[model samples]
Target chain A: MLVIEGLTKRYATGDLALDDVSLTVPKGQVMALIGPSGAGKSTLIRCVNRLVEPTAGTIRLGETVLTALGDRALRRARRRMGMIFQEYALVERLSVMENVLSGRLGYVGFWRSWFRRFPLADIEEAFRLLARVGLDHMVDKRADALSGGQRQRVGIVRALMQDPELLLVDEPTASLDPKTSRQIMRLIIELAKERGLAAIINIHDVALAQQFAERIVGLHAGRIVFDGPASDLTPEVLTTIYGEEDWSATIRKAEDDDEDEPPAVEAARIAAAD
Target chain B: MDAAAAARAWRPPPLIEAAWLRWAVYGGALLYAVLALGTLEVNWTRAAEGLERGGRFLGAFFPPDFVTHWLEIEEGLLESLTMTVTSTVFGVILSVPVALGASRNLAPMPIYLFCRGLIAVSRTFQEIIIAILFVAMFGFGPLAGMLTLAFSTIGFMGKLLAEDIEDIEKSQAEAVRATGASWFQLLAWGIQPQVLPRFIGLSAYRFDINFRESAVLGLVGAGGIGDTLNSSLDRYEFGTSAAILLIIIAIVMVCEYTSGFIRRAVQ
Candidate 1:
C-alpha cells in the first residue's frame, strides 16, 4: 500500500513539475496514471521512491515516512518498492542474468557483487524468473543484444526479483510495437495481480489503461484532475485529461472493428506523439 | 527580371575587415623574419666540412657493431621494458580513484576539485622534467623513471576516464538508484559497465606511451637505454649508439603493436 499527501515538486530550474498531488493505492490494486506529456505523472511515480525529492509533502509506504528517512534508511525502504523504466534500463554491458540478479543488490554485500558471486538462491531465483519470462535460453546474452520486447521482459523479471511490495511502472510499453505493447501490458497487470502487489502504472495509452486498470488517475499540468474507476472515465473525462481533441473519433476508430484498426495501434500512435 | 536578379545576388562580406591591422601583422612578421635572418651568423664552409666529418662518423656505424655491444643493448632494453610495465601497472591502479574523484557526476565538489588539482600538477610538467626532479630526490635509477611515468599516467588516464564517466547515460544510474541500490552498487553496476571498455583501451594506450618515454628517461640517468646511448655518443662510439637506437626502435615498434592489439580486443 502507498499513500501520498500534498506532494509538490519544483525542480532546481524552478519548473513546477508536481503540485499538491495526492493519491492512494490500496493493497493488490492496480492504478493507471494517464495524462499527456509533462503532466506530472512521472513526477508522482518518482516521488513515491523519493528518486526525485518532493519539494513538499509526505509519502508513506506501509508506515515508513519515505520523505523523513535518511540515506541509509531510504535505501532500505527502497527495497520494498520495485521500479520499471520506459527505456528498460538494464545495464546494457552486463549479461541478462547479471541484470536480473542485480535486483538483490540491496541485500548482497559489495564484495560479493563486485566479484559477481551472487548467492546460490538469488541465482536460482533469477534463472527461474528468466524462465518465467521465457528468456531462459538467453541468460548469458548481453542485455544490449536483446530485442526491445526481450529487454522489457528482462526489466520485468528484474523488478520481480526484488520481491517488492509495491510496483512503480513508468511507461512500461512506450517503446514496443502495438501487439507487443498489449502483451507487455497484459504481462505487467497479470504479474502484479498474481503477486498481490499494489502498482502505480504511468501510461500515455488511455485505452490500455482502461483495459488493464481497475482505477485510473489522470494528471494535467502538475495536478490531479481525475481519479475514479475506469468505467467512469467517459469521453468527456478523457478530453479533460488529454485536452480538447478528437477523442470520440479516435476511440471510435479504435473500437469500431479489429480489422479496421486495433486499439493498440491508435493508442500507441497517440502515446508515441506524447 | 534583370534588376530583381541583381538585387538578390548579394554575397556575404569577408570576415576580416580591418585591412590596416592585417597588413601591420604581416609587416611585423616579415620584419621579424628579416631581422632574425640577418642577425644569424653563417658558417657555410664550416657546415660543409662538418658534413664530410658526419659522413665518416656515420660510415663507422655501417655494420652496427651488434656482436660486441649486444649484451649492453639487451640489458638496457630489458630495463626499459621493466620500467614501462611497472609504471603502467602502478599508474593505472592509482588512476582509478583519482578518475572517480575527478568525475563531476560521481564525486563531491571538494573531491572533484582536489583530484582536478592533482591532474593539473601532473600535466603541468613533461615526463622528462618530472623524471629529472625525481632523479634528484630518489637518485639516478629506474625508480625515478617509473615514478615519473606513473605520475604522468595519472594525469592522462584520470582526465580521460573522468570525461568518459561524465558522458555515460544518466538514466541507467537513475534506474540503479531507484532500485534502492547503495552508492557503491550503483557505481559498480551502472557507471562501471559504461566506462570499463574505454578505460581498458586508454590504459593499454598509456602503456605504449610509457614504453617510448621510458626509453628516453635514462638520458638524465633515470635508467634505461638512453643512458647507454648517451654514454656511447659521449665516447664517440657511433656503432654502439646506432645499435642502441635500433634496439629502442624495435622495442617501441613491438610495444605499439601489442598495445594496439589489446585495445582492439577490448573494444
Candidate 2:
C-alpha cells in the first residue's frame, strides 16, 4: 500500500504545485489522477516517487519512508516505482532493446550497463516484455524510428522491465490519437491487473480515465477537490475539478461508451485486429 | 476600400525611435571612417616602388627548388604531422572531463566555475602567443608546439561540448534518472548518445584546426613546417619557401576534405 500524508510541493519559484495532498492507494488498485493544466496532478504523482521532492509531507511506500531516505537508499526505493512519461521520453539514439534494458539499471553495475552486458535473466525478461507488447521484431530499431503508438509501447515495456510494485504513468496518452489513447489506457489497466501493481495515472481525458481506472482523484489549484469511484464523477464533480464548462457532452460521452461491449473484450478485439 | 488601403499601408517599425538620433549615428560612423582613412597618410610613390619590387620577389619564387632542401622539409613536415596527431589525441581525451564539468546541468557550481575559468584562460591567448611562451619555457622544440595546440584545443572543444551537453533533451535524461540509474549510468545511457554525433563532428573539426595551427606554431621556434618556411625566407631561398608554402596548402586542403567526410559520415 502507498500512503501519502500531507504531501506538499512548493517549487523554488514559489509555486505551490501540491498543497497538503493526502491519499492512500491500496495494493493492486489503479487510480487515475484527473486535473486541469497546472492543477498539480503531475506533481502529486512525482512526489510519490520523490521525483518532485515534497516541500513538507510524508510519502510512505509500504514500509519504506521515501522522504527520509538518503541518495543511495532513494535510488533503491525508486527501482520499485516505474514511471511512464508523456511524448514517450526514450533516448532517441538508443535502440528499443537498450531502452527497455535501461529499466534494469539499478539492479546492474555501471560497467555492466555501460557495456550493454545485462544479466541473462534480465535480458530474457526484456525479450519477453517486448514480445508481449508485439515489438520483438523492432528491438534493433532506434527509438526515434518508431511511430507514436509503437514508441509508447516501448515506453510501457521499459517501465514493466523494472518489475515495479507501482507504476507512475504521467500523461501516457496525451500525444496519441483517441483510439490509440484508449488502447494504451486499456493496456496499462490490463498490465496493472496482471501484475497486481498499484498505479497512479495522471490523465487529461476524463472519459478515458473513467473507462480504465476504478478510482478517480480530482486535483485543482494544488488541492484535492474530489476522490471517489469513477462512476461518481458527475457533471458537478467535474465542474468542481476543472471549473465551469459544458461538461454534459463529456459526461454523456462517458456514459455512452459504458453502454457498449465490456472494455476488456473490446480492447482484446482491437488488439487482435492490430 | 478602407481594408484594402490598410492592408497596403503596412510598414516595419523603426529600429531607432528617434530619426535624428539614427541620422546622427550614421553620420558619426561615416565621419569616423573618413578621419581614419586620412590618418593612414598614403604614400603613392613609395607604394608604387614597392609594387615593382614585389613583382620581382614573386618572380624569384617560380620554378620552386624542392630537391635542395628536401631533407629539412621532410623532417619539418614529419614533426608537424606528429605534433598535430598526438596533440589532438591528448587534447580530446583531456577535454571530455572538462566539458562535463563545465556543463551547468552536469556539475556543481564550484566545478562549473573552475572549468569555465580554465576554458577562459586557455582562450585568452592566441595560439602564436601561447606557442611563444611555451617555447620560452620548454626551450624551442616540438614539445612546446604540442603543448600549445593541446592547451588551446581544451578551450575550443570543452566550451562547445559543454554547450552541447546543456542543450541535450532533458526529458530523455530525466527518464533515465527515473529508472534509478546511477549518475555514471545516467551519463552513459542518457547523455552520451544524444551528444555523440555533435561531439564527433567537433573533434574532427578541431583536428583540422589543430593541423593548420601546428604550421604556425613553428614561427615561435616551436618545431613544425613553419620552421622550414621561416629559415628558407631568412636565407632568401624564395624557391624553397614557395615549395614549403605549396606543401602546407596541400596538407591543409587534405585535412579539410578528410574532416568534412568524417563529419558527414557520422551525421
Candidate 3:
C-alpha cells in the first residue's frame, strides 16, 4: 500500500509542476493514471519512487515514511517497488541474465555484486523469470540485439525478478506496436494476477486502459479530474480531463465501435508533437 | 532591381575608412612591434655560431657501429624493454580504480574530484621530473623509471577512460539505478560495459607512450638504455649513439604498429 499527502512540486523556474495533491494506491490493484502529455503524470510517478524529490509532501510506502526517511532508509523501502520504463532501460551491453540479475542488487552488497556473487536463490529466480517470460534462450544474448517487444518483455521479467510487492510501469507499451502493446498489457495483467502484486500504470492509451485496467484515474493541470471504474470513463470524462471536448468526443465515439482499431503509432506521434 | 542589387553589393572602400576597432587592432599590433624591436636583439652572429656548432655535433654521428660493444648494447636494450613492459603492465593495473573514481557520471562528486586531482598532480610535471624525484627517493634504479611511467600512464589513461564513461548512454545507468544497485554495482554493470573497449584501447596507447618515456627516464639515473645513451653522449661516442637511436626508432615503430592493430581490433 502507498499513501501520499499534499504532494507539491515546483521547478527551479518557479513553476508548480505538481500542486497540492494526494493519491492512494491500495495493495494488489492495477490503478491506471491516464492523462495527456505534460499533465504531471511522469512527475507524479517519479515522486512516488523518490527519483524526483517533491518540494513538499509526505509519502508512506507501507510503514516507511518515504519523505521523512534518510537516503539509506528510502533506498531500503524502494526495494519493495519495481519500476518499468518505456524505453525498456535494459543495459545494452549486459546480457539478459545480467540485466535480470540486476534486480537483486538492492539485497546484494557492493563488492559482492561487482564480482557477481549474488545468492544462489536470486540467480535461480532470475533464470526462472527468464523462463517465465519465454526468454530462456536469450539468457546469454546482449540486450541491444532484442526487438522492442522482446526488450519490453525482458523489462517485465527484470521487474518481476525483483519479487517486488508493487510494480510501477510507465508507458509500458509506448515504444511497441498495437499488438505488442496488448500483449505487454496482458502479460502485466497475468503476472499481477498470478503474483497478487499491486500495480500502478501510467498510460496514454484510453482504449488500452479500457481493455485492461479495472479502475482508471484521469489527471489534468496537476489535479485529479476523474476517478471511476473503467466502464464509467466515458467521452464526457475524457473531454473534461483533456480540457477539450470537440476532438476527443468524436474520437471517443469512433473508438466505441467494436470494429475500430486506433492508430497507436500515429496517435503517439501526434501526442509527442503536442 | 539593378539599383537594389548594387546597393546590396559591398566592398572595402579605403584604409582610412576602416572601422575604429580595426584601427585600434592595427595600432595595438604597431605597439607590439615597437615593444618587440626594443626588447629583442638581432644576433645573427650568435645564431650562426649555434648552427655551426649543431652541424659539427651532427658530423660526429656518422656510420652507426652496432657490431662493437654489441654486448653492452644488448644489455641496455633488454633493460629498456623490461622497464617498458613492466611499466605498461603496472600502469594499466593502477589506472582501473582511478578511471572508475574519476568518471563523473559514475562516481560521487568528492571521489571524482579526488581522482581527477590525483591525475592532475601526476601529470603536472614531465615524466623526466617524476623520474628524477623517484631516483632521489628510491636511489637510482629501474624501479624509479617504472614508477614514473606508471604514474603518468595512470593520469593519461584514467582521464581518457573517465571521458569515455561520460559518453555512455544515460538510460542504461538509470536502469541500473532503478534496480537499486549500489554505486559500485551500478558502475560495474552499467559503466564498465560501455567503457571497457575504449579503456583497453586507451591503455594500449598509454603503453606505447610509456615505452618511449621509459627509455628517456634512464637519462635521469633511473635505469634503462637512456643510461647508456647519456654515457655515449658524455664520452662523445656519436657512432654508438646513432646505433642506439636506430634501435630506439625500431622499438618505437614496433610499438606504434602494435597499438594501431590493437585499436583497430577493439574498435
Candidate 4:
C-alpha cells in the first residue's frame, strides 16, 4: 500500500502547488486523480516519487518511508516506483531497446550499462515486455522516429521494465487523441492489474477516468475536495470540484453506450443528454 | 460611427514615449558622428604618393616563386598541421569536463562560476597575443602556438557546449533520474544523446578554426607558415610571400570543406 500523510508542496517561487493532502492507495488498486489545470494533480503524483520534493509530508510505499531516505537510499527506493511522463520522455536519439533498458540502470553497474552489456535476464525481460506491448519489432528504431501512440507504448514498457510495485503516471493521455487516450488508459489499467501493482494516474478527461479507474480523487487548488468510487461522481460533486458549471453532460450514466463514437457525435450525444 | 472608426485606427506605440527626448537622442547621435568624422585629418597628398608605391609592391608579387623557398614552406606547413591536430585533440579532451561544470543546469553554483571564469580568462586575449606570450615563455616554436590555440579552443568549445547542455529537454533528463539512474548514467542516457550532434559539429568547427589560428601564430615566432611568410617579407621576396599566402588560403579552404562534410554527416 502507498500511504501519504499531510502532503504539501510550496515551490521556491512561492506558489503553493499542493496543500495538506492525505490519501492512501492500497495494492492492486488503480486510482485516477482528476482536476482542472493547476489543480495540483501532477504535483501530487510527483511528490509520491519525490520528483517534486514535498514541503511537509511523509510518503510510505509498503515498508519504506520515501521522504526521509538519503541520496543512495532514495535511488534504491525510486526503483520500486515507476513514473510515466505525458511527453513520452524517451531519450530521442537512443534506439527503442536502449530506452526500454534504461529502467534497469539502478540495477546494473556503470561500466556494464555504458558498454550496452546488460545481463541476459534483463534483456530477456525487456524483450518480453516489448513483445507484450506489441513493440518488439521496432526495438531497433530510434524513439524520435515513432508516432505519438507508439512512443507512449515505449514509455509504458520502459516503466514496466523497472518491475516497480507502484506506478506514478502524470497526464498520460493529455497529448493524445481521444481514441488513443482511451487506448493508453486501458493499457495502463490492464498492465497495473496484470502485475498487481497500485497506480495513481493523473488525468484531465473525466469520462475516461470514470471508465478506467475504480476510484476517483478530485483535487481543486491543491486540496482533495472529493474522494469516492466512480459511481459517486455526480454532477454536483464535479461542480464542487471544478467550480460551478453545467456538468450534467460530463457525468456518464451506467447505461450509457461506450462505443467508439467520433468526437463530434460524442460531443453531440453529451449535449443531447444534457 | 465616426467615433467607432476612430477607435479602430490603431498604430504601434512609439519606442520612446517623449517626442522631445527622442528627437534629442537622434540629434545628439548625428552631431557626434559629424564631430567624429571631422577629427580624422586626411593627408591626401601623402596618400597619393603611397598608392603609387603600393602599385609597385603589388607588381613584385606577380610571377610567384614557389621554387626558391619550397623546403621552408613545406616545413612550416607541416609544423602548422601538426600543431592544429595535436592542440585540437588536447583541447577537446579538456573541454568536456569544463563544459559540464559550466552548465548552469548541471553543476553547482561554485563550479559553474569557476568554469565560466576559466572560459572568460581564456577568451580575453586574441590567439596572436597569447601566442606571443607563450613564445616569449617557451622560447619560440610550434609548442607555444599549439598551447595558445588549445587554450583558446577551450573557451570557444566550453561556452557553446554549456549553452547546448542548458538548452536540453529537462523532461528527458528527469525521466532518466526518476529511473534511479546515477548522475553519470543520467549524463550518458539523457544529456549526452541530446547534445552529441552539436558537440561533434563544434569540435569539427574548432579544429578548422585552430588550423587557421596556427598559421597566424607563426608571425609571433611560433612556428607555422606565417613565419615563412614573415621572413620572405623581411627579405622583400614578394613572390615567395605570395606563394606562401596562396598555400595558406588553399589549406583553409580544404579545412572548411572537410569540417562542413563531417558536420553534415553527424547530423
Highest DockQ model number = 4
Scored by lDDT, model 4 comes in at: 0.91
Candidate 1: Cα lDDT at A225: 91
Give candidate 2's TM-score.
0.95
| lDDT, each prediction | 0.88, 0.92, 0.82, 0.91
The lDDT-based order of candidates, best leading, equals 2, 4, 1, 3
The CA lDDT at B260 in model 3 is: 84
Candidate 2 lDDT over B86-186, as tens digits, reads 99999999999999999999999999999999999999999999998999899988999999999999999999999999999988998898889999998
- Better structure of 1 and 4 per TM-score: 4
Off by over 4 Å in 2: A257-274, B1-9, B17-24
lDDT of 1 by residue, B1-267 (tens): 698897799657656668888788889999999999999998999999999998998888777777777788778878888888999999999999999999998899999999999999999999889999999999998889989999999999999999999999987888888777899999899999999999989998999999889878989999988777888888878888888878778877887898889889877
Which CAPRI category fits model 2? high
Give the clashing residue pairs of candidate 1, or none: none
Every candidate's CA RMSD: 4.8, 2.3, 5.9, 4.2
Error of 1 at B182 (Å): 1.7
Taking the tens digit of each residue's C-alpha lDDT, what string does model 1 give over A185-274? 877887898899999999998877877789999999999999999878878998888888777665554343335556767676444322
iRMSD per prediction, in order: 0.8, 0.6, 1.3, 0.6
Residue B179's lDDT in candidate 1: 72
Number of clashing residue pairs in every model?
0, 0, 0, 0
